[model samples]
Target chain A: MEKFKKNERVVALIKILSDNPNQVITLNRFSELLNAAKSTISEDISAARKIIECLALGEIETIPGALGGVKYKPILTLEQSLEFLKRLCTELKDPSRIIPGSFIYMSDVLGNADQVATIGRIFASCFKEKNADYIVTIETKGITPAIMTARAMNIPLVIARTGNRVTEGTTISVNYVSGSKKIQTMSVSKRSIKEGSKVILIDDFMKAGSTIKGLKDLMSEFKAEVVGTGVIMSTAEPDHKVIDDYVSLLILNDVDETSKTISIIPGIK
Target chain B: MEKFKKNERVVALIKILSDNPNQVITLNRFSELLNAAKSTISEDISAARKIIECLALGEIETIPGALGGVKYKPILTLEQSLEFLKRLCTELKDPSRIIPGSFIYMSDVLGNADQVATIGRIFASCFKEKNADYIVTIETKGITPAIMTARAMNIPLVIARTGNRVTEGTTISVNYVSGSKKIQTMSVSKRSIKEGSKVILIDDFMKAGSTIKGLKDLMSEFKAEVVGTGVIMSTAEPDHKVIDDYVSLLILNDVDETSKTISIIPGIK
Candidate 1:
């Protein structure tokens, strides 16, 4: 095999590590793939680390010993995350986003791939230390960000449906009252989650946190631990929520249909 | 400004291009970022392209002239895609996957971020040439791969809801008969898709292709053109489908409850 230049080897190394975030890749494997010596691969990783951290791109972690290898951590700094959220707040504050019921229409923002990836990175930064085995969310609105968060963390995602369905095989169902005082049923497959696994719950919006509270109850039935929770938006009013420990990306202060004005800010200072 | 080493520069270039797949980044920008000359950045891009294509990782194409720049295309070769599908088939063939009513429980596979990302890469490779404006799906199961596809293509994602909702603002509703011979209402926010836009429809499963057919009809209402369509799996029983042109990654032949075996294969040879 022809020897690859240092620059070429570094590019390939970064591509693989970034593609599979948080997944370890042993130096022996990289050595075989790049056809380079272990010492040379080590040097490449050192250079990659400097480039990543110096640019504030993220982190490049190297685990030592026989089973250890290199992995990419897409952690964002406080300033970087706040800058992203501030831009999001500006875009979301556009008066045209207000609907008739004084609700802000943010479906487009949530559905955009890169935007959600950034949001997921923020959530991943918050909960990556939890050693979560899965990222959980309900169907419909929450799936996008939850999947992204799961992707960033390199974990499986579990979706809870609003109603029980036969397609999922034997399932466990729980009925809980939503924020509006309406009763709703949520169900998950019996085997979707392993018992005693730690999970991070993610969603797009929260009003009174009733749905999340219900989701927590459902997690309990699975014998899973809710290590952390994150939401994109939460209403400013009703400061006290049904769930006590969860992170919200944005705080939606007001939506005036009549005045066509919206007041929103990043959830974290 | 301080200058960086060649290896460090290539690493940064590869990271940004891979992070935003198919999004163009000009040499001038790279030159500015790395504090290097345009010609130096050009050489770096050439080396990166050779390394990427040499390893069969993907493609790094550089467009010439004033407005042209470099972009990463995560296209999978025939051998690469088939190998991935074959591995998936092995995992999915486990007899334990069969639930009652002869349905295979695949939520775990669908929600696995890395798995879906590969599927999306295949779809993106198939449809990236169509100049699609958005990737569309009808909520729930399809959202994961669809969002991933959209991510790979660097486009927006438009999700059609099951019903008209006030939260999305003024909405457009369409009634379409699904694969199960059930009349279903699917709606998209009027502003979700612009008039005369081009889109690609993606879904998790297609039995009779009724849902996809319905989705195509909904696109007609917006005067949008569906440039392409893709599904992760399609039933082999229905040799004839409502939609004629679509790509399926896997063809689900049968789920024999009595035999405790599943007949499945890669969608394409």
Candidate 2:
């Protein structure tokens, strides 16, 4: 703790931001961290923000809320993030990667750069609003964005692991049916979250609501609140909760595997 | 394209690095970029390195090679990275995450902040070698590390998708078993990468060789070479590959579903 003086203020600010979870903070709140006057804290913050911004790190936004303050956009610019995703897509786009159904496989995209960067930035940005204390994602696809967002917000990222990891802690498993006409069970740990914390649910693709519902069932044990839900991409297939209020990077309306025709639509930027 | 100065020397230097992944770079090769006097280029490099180091962003390591040039440790310090990983694990270790047989799932650790920061530092360190052309990862779990790693390396991050999307020009899919015992297919598109790219692969977990093998197959199609492979965690499963060189944060030995005992081990620093 003693060695933290030089970086204390920044560290303190980071902790405050983390504790707020999906909420934005104004200059006034940051000023209260120290005995220094609001102006002095503001000056320090401006200098700190410059360093972070120049690095293409996080962002700072001013919200006109009733208790308006400068909110940190834990997310980065879309341009900055797209480059990372483009790279991943590029590699996966290789002719060698061609498969039978004309379906472009993307296990790597779920785990690669641009997709990861965009996921991180978006999650961070979404949580910049208050009331989001934790990030939740269905096993497999949803974990990527959930991780990125949780980390940016400096909060814990909880995963509803697809099934059971026999060697870990306690688990909460829920069974659900997929559109593919298969029933599956997803599980999560009982120790990875806090009671009453607001949770944001995320998924990679939402063809149905079963998986999201499974996550909701799991959260029930913790008595947590579902603050928001998001998806990276979505299809036109209906029958899901429609995600109370959601954000998506792209929308794939139709995929004709035979014609090799695919439609890609950018989400609300 | 016109914006990049045609520094044949710098280009050549980078190429040399790409060919030799994870190796240190000396000043002599840097001088070769400009065909300038060794002493002159040395000074320029020193200035350049100063700017880089001053940013507290990337590492510009200096090693005294046999040829008496500098060898940079482009990777992050083990201590810094370990600390961050521990913090992530601790946070992910929330008590509210307890599920019966499930664990505090960490599929998303790939893109979370502490992990991303640590991963960024680590990959940035690798880029200091000046050879990594691209960062690679299989879909889903690999995206987070690949994104942070690519960001740190300031290179493009490539992902292997699972299915083909029409938006992608051309794609190749390979069938392989993911860690979960599911024989799933992975995909990548054509024209995403050129031949002979030096790539660093990062993944969230490595329980089986299938996904990596699928990625390797995809890479082979593009004539791209795998320079390094990284993971956040690896399980000591009999089915796991032992010969492949990888960097991981933690190692899981056995997950006893009945006893609720999970044996954990730390990876090499």
Top TM-score model = 1
TM-score of each: 0.98, 0.59
lDDT of 2 by residue, A122-143 (tens): 6566546665877888645565
Per-residue lDDT of B1-269 in model 2, one digit per residue for the tens?
11222222222232233222234666666555445667665654454344334433234445665666643333556565666666665655554433454443554454355556566566565445547787777655556566666655646666676665554556677787765788777776565666888877777777765677778777877788877777767777754483386666677676565555555565656
lDDT of each: 0.92, 0.59
User: Which digits, one per residue and each the tens of the lDDT, describe model 1 over residues A205-262?
Assistant: 9999999999999999989999999999999988989888889999999988888899
Best by DockQ: 1
Clashing pairs in 1: none
DockQ of each: 0.90, 0.16
In candidate 1, stretches whose alpha carbon ends up further than 4 angstroms from where it belongs are none
Interface RMSD after interface superposition, each candidate: 0.7, 11.0
Tens digits of per-residue lDDT for model 1 on B69-96?
9999999998999999999999999999
Candidate 2 lDDT for residue A135: 80
TM-score of 1: 0.98
